[model samples]
Target: MKKILLIALIGYGGWQFYQKQSVAQPVTEPTVQVLPDYTVPLQKAREAASLLQFRCDGRQHCSQMKSYDEAVFFLRNCPDTKMDGDNDGIPCERQFNKG
Candidate 1:
């Protein structure tokens, strides 16, 4: 009886080991998708800013204006451009130095 129990335990352990070894690992690869280089038109940026009551100081209104692409993201994603610059929950009016 003791020998039978020991053999059964060994067999179970071996089966568990084999099962773990046989399991396949998931393969991960970076996705490749063609995306057009997007930029916000100057007119569109000005229009959005104007709609939000944003005042351009000197040459530009918001220092957050790094590029047209960034501006486009802001215009599209930011609900409150006048109040949110970073788009990280903090309002733009509160984040910008002038604001």
Candidate 2:
């Protein structure tokens, strides 16, 4: 009877240990990067721009952006910036310093 009780106690302890381990393990959800609020406008612009055909005007390219914000808008909204050589979100490394 003691041997049976010992076996049952061991099984109960093992199950409790498993339950604790399972609960201790973190359940990870996929992480997503949230952009700045300024980018929100650019996202809306992209939707409008998508309707139009894109061509490298050379006159209206990403390099011509006078400011970083303008470059970001173009890079994000305009599909034909031709500035992001690395295909990164940034545009005009020589001009903007950042992508």
Candidate 3:
């Protein structure tokens, strides 16, 4: 009788442990990616500004304009400006200086 009771108690404990472990674990959901509010063309324009060596000039004028538009504006309005540090005709190439 004692042996049978011990076996039954051990079996019940094992079943409780298994049930607890199964209930504790949860299923996770997948994450989603989000896009920015700016248009693709506007983002391209910003890249052009960096190439053109268009700086903030402490006035924040170019901050509002997209990169490409800023480059075009600088090139057209300030042709004599020495943006092309290497004098390579390409205003804002790698050799150009921001300061």
Which candidate wins on lDDT?
2
Candidate 3 residue lDDT tens string, 1-99:
999999999999999999988885677898898967865688787767565666534322333344544644565565345444554445454323343
Range of the 10 consecutive residues with the lowest summed lDDT in candidate 3: 56-65
lDDT of 2: 0.67
- List, in order, the clash count of every candidate structure: 5, 2, 3
The candidates, ranked best first by lDDT, are: 2, 1, 3
Worst 10 residues of 1 by lDDT: 53-62
lDDT of 1 by residue, 5-92 (tens): 9999999999999999999999999999999999999999887765575433323224567544444445555554553445554333
Q: Model 1 off-target regions past 4 Å?
A: 30-99
- The TM-score that candidate 1 achieves is 0.29
The superposed Cα distance between candidate 1 and the true structure at residue 54, in angstroms, equals: 56
The alpha-carbon lDDT assigned to residue 27 of candidate 2 equals: 81
Best by TM-score: 2
Model 3, residue 91: what's the lDDT? 49
The C-alpha TM-scores of every prediction are 0.29, 0.36, 0.27
- The residue-by-residue lDDT of candidate 2 on 1-99, one tens digit each, is 999999999999999999988886678999999977664588678755654534234434654767666665566666556667787767667786773
By how many angstroms RMSD does model 3 differ from the true structure?
12.0
RMSD of each: 12.6, 13.8, 12.0
